[model samples]
Target: MNLADTIAAVATPPGDGAVAMVRVSGRRARAIAAATFRPSAGKPLQPRRFTHGFVVDAATGTVVDEVVAAWLPAPRTYTREPTLEVTCHGGRAATAAVLQAILRAGARLAEPGEFTLRAFLNGRIDLAQAEAVRDAVSAPSADAVAMAVAQANGSLSRVIREVRDPLADLGARLEGSLDFADDGVPELDRGTARAVLEAAATRVDALLATAGPGRVRRHGLRVVLAGMTNAGKSTLFNALLGSDRAITSDEAGTTRDAIEEILPVGAAAIVLVDTAGWRPPGEMPVGEAERLSGARTDASIPLADVVVHVVDGTAPHHATAGRERIAALAPGGAMLEVWTRADLHRGLHAGNQVAPGDQFRVSAITGEGIQALRSSLHARAVAGSRGAGSDSGGELLTNARHVDALRRAREAIDRAMAVVAGAMPDDLLAADLRAAVAACSEVTGEMIGDDVLERVFRTFCIGK
Candidate 1:
């Protein structure tokens, strides 16, 4: 935690690879590098350029590993401190030995996310950008990667500032009017102040609107396939995934547990879950295995964002009962009714049945209506992530912390607008505006506390 002390850590992942990196930062970084590394050309280390060298023990002069090292001077480095990076042949022992030599020469191991924390503390990047770095590193899909990269480049920060700056200027005006009223300074105009407050609130609302899609993009949509036994759930699951991940059979209760796979659809991913078929308990004498399978299906159905209720195309009588069961299980989730074995249905009577939601007739064996179902799933995924009022294509409020902060800011702004409408004192108006500004500052890390910093950075891996 001490900024004056030098820190070092293995920056690469712990595994065997072609190469690994050890990073050092602080005033003593260059000194530690010099003590442990000897340049192959026998020259002093130069700034910003990689030099071939050998890392050795200072006491025994025994070689540890051959490396390519770089020295970066203060004021231009990631932490705005003198920095050193060494690339060595990769393996657990070689990477550990290089880091150990640096530690022996005088460098403490960095705490989790300490490197990015230093970058924030040194004014190289804001708090939002720091969080974005973690998101980019751990993104699950290509779309997620692009979104995280945009956020790290300050897309969200720019949006916050755009909404915050005008309110700040208005607050300053209010303060000036209160402090210098006797010196003939102009009093604030209530109408203009109200307009500004309203505009700022609108912008904050727009940001909040993105939170739903942002969450869906960050964590994929959960879509569960539920149906009666032998209703072709496993076959359709394989057809959707384009692979035989689930065991399909004519036997009832073949799937005893939920099987899950991820299907990428446009800018979002669908977590497709195939649950065990449900059978009414009293209709047939049930065994313990059948009870467990039904329990798992019940558990998975309620948690899904979309529950696909599969019905056998040949059995027209079971459709009403299936719909009732699905409604009872997933009352709040979106429902899609699918009739399997379209190839076997010779007439339109079964397919024309009235359904509450979307209905699709699909034949997993013949590939009939599969593409249409896939398209529907993709549309639902994209609709959930749409950036409603935002002009920035992919910029969204993905983190819950960010959404909460913005909500607080919007509430504060709403209070300020009410104070203006009531013709309240300038001091009261200024206080609310200041509160709004502080809330926005918290998002960018300009006015955050140590506890919040610890919570945010602790999620990051060490040497970040």
Candidate 2:
């Protein structure tokens, strides 16, 4: 927490704009800026003041750029250290010059996520709030921004505290019960402990449920469209995107690669991908066109969070020998059987079984069942998040790490619960409870070490 090294970075997004921000944070932040900063007005780097200045090099003293430096002196700033943010002319060269001058004046380049990490270490924010800062910065939509802002302001930290507080108290009491057992007094009643554990477990479950929705707000959904070429796949893509992104042609196999676009589906943007149509298994794929198309289609299938299998309404199901093929190649995903070109098959329709084991529908042209399809898609992607919708009806694990930790925790807790029920001894119950607590701690990084932090941050881009 005693960081003498000042960290600086261009905080604004990299681009040409009217203005950009260069941020500096740490104990020596003001001094580092003073080395290169030539302020023209206001109380000079005082406790609180914004000064107009021409940032310059310390040695030769050449001007870098005109900037507004506002000082938020020690312990009362982000990172709980003295901080200075310079608003400079927006451009690659001007922004770079200001930051370079700060660096030349002795500020170290901040590592990706270092500023937030420093904030965490200095107690200005918790891990969750620190993470919320990143989410808030990278928010794509207004809703996500609002949610991230709420979280950064400590909504999730409060919820986490509400759930984690009792557990911590229970843990302390349990430890006390063991330590002072011979004193003839119990710190926590057995029944009360059971009730408290159950309540904590229930709260964890609710939080786990909300995690999906939270991630959805952070990352948009993935919706992929697949079927035989000329099944009106491009038309459907055009309809959803409200633009002609993919070329429409009557020729079969017109599309040979995956085409993805963001479509506004309710409050969230769903990434819709139109893949190369599913081809017959051994159709003597004679050229690069055939091979690449098939490969891309196969690759796209596994990548889909949800699949919309387009079935040509005008074609006989058995003629192309594909109804069974499409069913067999269901891609292990949330699928919707779509009967495309429904306008051409109104009277002749005999209620198709296009998606034998999934929901089937009709239309690409003439808008024959698009609304129903929209509703189905909406049901699949809840509020702009990735993965499956809410009704997937299973405690579907969200984070792979959480899933692994909770699986271990569940087993440990179950063992402890059994032992507490007198099915096993108290000593065994206590040990199992400790193990469960350790497992739960993993999810919150309580049991994590420096190596894990290194691994986590290494995956992040620098200057985060």
Candidate 3:
């Protein structure tokens, strides 16, 4: 946390790779680099240029590792401070040795997200952009990466500023009218103020509308496959994933736990969960492990964004029981009925009561209707993502924190609208406007507390 002391950390991921980065930033970044690194050409490190060097231990002067180091001067670097980055040969030992040498040269180890926190503190990027950096690095799909990249590039920040600026201006005008009443300053027009508030609310609502899809993009959609015992759930799961992730068997309750895998469907990712088949207690004598497995399946059902009720196509009784169980569970989200072993039974049985469009028949063994089933699941995934609205191909409000802040801002604006409609005192109206502006400012970190910053940045990986 001390800005005066240089900080160093391995910026790259752990384990072996082609290269690893050791980053040092602060007032003494250049000095630490000079002390720990010896340029191969007998020249000092140059600004904005990479130099071939050998990292040396400060105390013993032993060669730690050969590296290519870059010196970035203050005011233009990521932290707007003097920064030195040494790209050493990849591997835990080499990266660790390089970082240790830098620490030995007087640089302290950087905390989790301290590097990006420095960037935010130095005004290089706002809080939203800082969060976006984390999202971009961990985005699960290509679409998610695009959304995060756009936000990191300040798309969401621009929208927040657009909403905040006018509200702040209106609040200032209201304050001026109240304070300078006897000084002949013009009184603020209620209609103009109302118009501004309404416009700001509309913009915030648009951004809020993106929250559902934003969440879907940021965290893959949760899809659970549930059904009666021996209903072919695992086989269908493997078919959908194109891998044998879940074990299959003819014996009931073979899977005693929830098995999960990430399956990318089209542009979206699905967190596919295959759970133990459901059966009423006492209908079949079950052991403690089977009881726990059923409980786990019950637990996973409610959390799913989409629940695929897998039924045995050859068993008419299974279709009826599956429907009843699904109704009892009431997943409270999108639902699909998939009839497995379609190769054995070519069509829907008499027990299937679901509409034609909502049900699918597939055979995991013969691959019959497998692609069609995948397409149907993909369609459902896409539908879940579009619940808020159609993606306009712009920035999305992916972070829950940003969504909560916008919701609060929208509520304040609604209150401000009410104040205007009631012709309330300018002071009351200004109070609400100020609250709305502050809420928006919180999104951009223009008016945020240290606790929130700590909570936000602490989620980042060390050396980010």
Which candidate wins on TM-score?
A: 3
Q: Model 3, 211-284: lDDT tens per residue?
A: 88778888778889999888899999999899988999998889988999888988887889999997733367
lDDT (C-alpha, whole model) for all candidates: 0.87, 0.68, 0.86
Better of 1 and 3 by lDDT: 1
**Model 1, span 213-291: residue lDDT tens:** 7877776677899988888899999999999999999988889989899898876788899988877434551689888
The candidate scoring highest on lDDT is 1
Backbone collision count in every prediction? 0, 5, 0
User: Runs in model 3 with CA error above 4 Å?
Assistant: 280-285, 350-353, 386-393
Candidate 2 overall Cα lDDT vs. reference? 0.68
Alpha carbon deviation, residue 379, candidate 3 (Å): 3.4
Clashing pairs in 3: none
- Compared with the true structure, model 1 gives a TM-score of 0.84
| TM-score of every model versus the real structure | 0.84, 0.82, 0.93
lDDT-based ranking, best first?
Answer: 1, 3, 2
